[model samples]
Target: MIKEQGLSVQHVCQSMSIGPTAVRRWVEQYDSEQAGQPGIGKPLTPEQQRIRQLEQENRQLRGDVEILKKGVGLLCPRAEMSFRLIDELQTKAIPVSQSCRVLGVSRSGFYEAKRRAAAPVVCKASVHLRAAFVASHQSYGSRRMVAELSNRGIAAGRFKVRRLMRQAGLKPVWKRKFIHTTDSKHDLPIAANVLARQFNPAAPNKAYVSDITYVRTGAGWLYLAVVIDLFSRKVVGWAMAPSMPAKLVCDALHMAVQQRRPGEGLIVHSDRGSQYASAQYQAKLASHGFICSMSRKGNCWDNAVAERFFLNLKMERVWQREYANHAEAKIDIAAYIVGFYNSERLHSVLGNLSPSVYERNMAAKKPIVVSEFT
Candidate 1:
């Protein structure tokens, strides 16, 4: 009956009118003295709690060691990394056998993972494709991602890259609202259309583009203006101000002129915003011998290149980083431009070379051009 009803031993004993003394004596003798460590009615002391904790930690450590041993036994192969290890195998003074023992890996297991096999001429190609997939938000649909992979010297078709991306759990970023924040309707005087939508530059400092964009911080907003050299896409001059005004754009232009000292006939292009049209802004450009240019009314495409630069700047950096305030953002933006974007980051349009590198290469070819970066 007790078994059918799921009664515990204590309840079954009471129902059967049997004393628990005998069961208690049996437990005391058969069970370990350390069972729960409180013995009979005694309460556990702090020292006992500490002992229990230590025992649990020791057991966990033992389990971890066992798992590691199993993993070492399995020893999955890692191609190039294993080759490097083998090359260094006998170069050191220590015996290889002892070194293997110290490394906690069996010699046979190490060799198994290290043995050279026929290179996957095709698979290596897939890896390069995979890297592009990984970099492109991993969200590229099979066809586009595959096209991108194939374009980058990988021989794999769309199906293969798609399968690889799925296996690796990659996906491109979701499309978000395209924020159009540069408003040109202010009552300020507009600069005359000097660039006339001509963006092509034959050499460095021949044409420059300038624009203002807003960055959001925890405290509020920060406005940044940049003047980029059209020849190499380098940001020659930049300024950050609390508000967007004629002074904000002017400050950036001043810095660029000071650093590059672009001679007369240089084309400076921007939107037909009041700031750019202001007499002060036009005078500054005129004093530097730059021909001021403005985009056509209500046409963002007229200043498309400048707008594109801002889009890239936001997408590649500001969108990914968190800033506590304007000051923090300023510091990071400076580092991004001077330390990474100009000096290191590769641009596909610029033949996969950094802006600074492209500029340097161009300068080398045309030694007559005189320009300096501050």
Candidate 2:
């Protein structure tokens, strides 16, 4: 009304019942709008107001486009990877919900990803858990998995390991019933249980346990004999053959002697199987000045360590694979014993250390004496 009537500012203020400053400011805004010039206050003209609205909308659209561009450019097939990108953008002042919306990701999922990333320990634990599980041939339970993580300097509790394992779908292989391969009905003289139930020895090569287990193959059953040192629970010797004969146990013991030449009177314990009680096996022990000890008839606990090893072998590797022939079974079983069991597998008895590592650590503390036995 003031602009069209050409009234003075003081007159307009008194007539309109508005303050002098308000009247003046509205007049200046109107003048600027009419002249198509920008002003500090809201535009009075419809065209100017429309322009201002469109400019604001354009700016908002540009921002949305920029966000979409970043989201699309960084987006991957995996949601986790995309969430990481969104997290990066968030640090640069981008709203997480906006980025998630543009990327077609749920806000909750993005936040979950953020929460996981916040815990580097959990992330690292997840990685180490999978690796340790795979490295263990999917045979490690939550307890051993936690120990493996601890060995790697990653602190993870059993419950946490179990949770992460369940989340990752890391289920260990189930164990089947153990098959008894020992035939104790033979006429061969059995050695007395001299070693008794003393499974843990103070020194390596002081006592050794041997056992034989059969593996199924297309060709036939392949027998495997292993000699474990009582001190380190290490497979000091192992031999595989298509037949379970006296020579098989002898060969395993021979390998054990070659690897660890124990002093005289070292106890060599085994179940009262015919192969173990055979004259050939007895002669082998006598030649090396070793004492022979046999488990009581039908008693498996006397050589429980060896039985446990066989159980582990079947559960972890043999049962998981299909062997076409003796050669295949032999190769795979050898790999499991050497590559995985002795070198990498965690032994609960040995404080979660691999057999090789336990031996090496112990040998360092007290150098193992290699006895001369030609």
Candidate 3:
């Protein structure tokens, strides 16, 4: 009406029931198309509209080609890797459903992969479990493995750890039968079992248990004595020698005394071995004002904590290798006690904390009482 009847834009808008702005825009677009120039929005002429449609189709085709090329490049023998690539592309603004369709992967599989990727614990737990197993000399079962993982800030249950361990083919060393090393058949007087199966002490340095065990080496036997504090199950002192004499037990006691410096009346329990009954060992205890307590004759269970420690030492470290001499055995056993058992090995009795860790935690919870030796 504006072109044929020479109507004003306002008149045309009124007649067409439209706004004046729309009339003005339509006139301008018509003029632009007639003059073979591009205009914004839908074209006013069929030729321009066809060109716009073709351009849109061309862009769509280009996008399709790009998607197909990427899909081909991302194809892999492993579906998991492909899913990971798809995830990366989705983060880069690629459509997940479209990518999955182009890559011939199910959308459900891609979503599952996304869920697994979001929760990294599943993958990380397996890796950390294997490393911890190896680090513990392959002697950590699922229970200890769970504790170790918890220490590392990974929350995992025993069943989960067990499954991961089984998948990794990890098997811990099993414990063997305990060997008796106590010889109480002597005329020396024996102290009463004052401890009387009181394996758990309420406070540090209150009570201690000592025992001696032999390690086999190419150069013969190497004897090891340990003094364990019942409070934390920590090996407060240890000594290794070629013979199990009064000196061996005494040296171990001396180390314990020097480290702990327990007060007078500290109950020092040990098996009724000949060394414990010897005058030298008894006098050493008497000099420190420490009360001696002997385990009953032929009863390993009476001093079971000390015996268990030796059993663990043999099962985890001693039996695993053949030492050439006492020096080699001493070095290795010392490493097991100080480096691993004291600092890293988890004890069920100590609530899955290593002996050193248990002591440190207890000291943190309360003030330690240091004693002056008499």
Q: Please provide TM-scores, in order, for all candidate models, with all chains considered together.
A: 0.57, 0.68, 0.69
RMSD of each: 21.8, 10.1, 10.7
Ranking by TM-score: 3, 2, 1
- In order, candidate lDDTs are 0.72, 0.87, 0.86
Candidate 3: which pairs clash? none
Winner by lDDT between candidate 3 and candidate 1: 3
Alpha-carbon error at 297 in model 2, in Å?
1.3
Candidate 3 per-residue lDDT, tens place, 229-261, comes to 998888888898988889999999999999888
**Model 2 agreement with the true structure over 94-148: per-residue lDDT tens digits:** 9988778677779998877777666665666898889889988899999999888
Q: After superposition, how far is residue 132 of candidate 3 from its true place, in Å?
A: 0.8
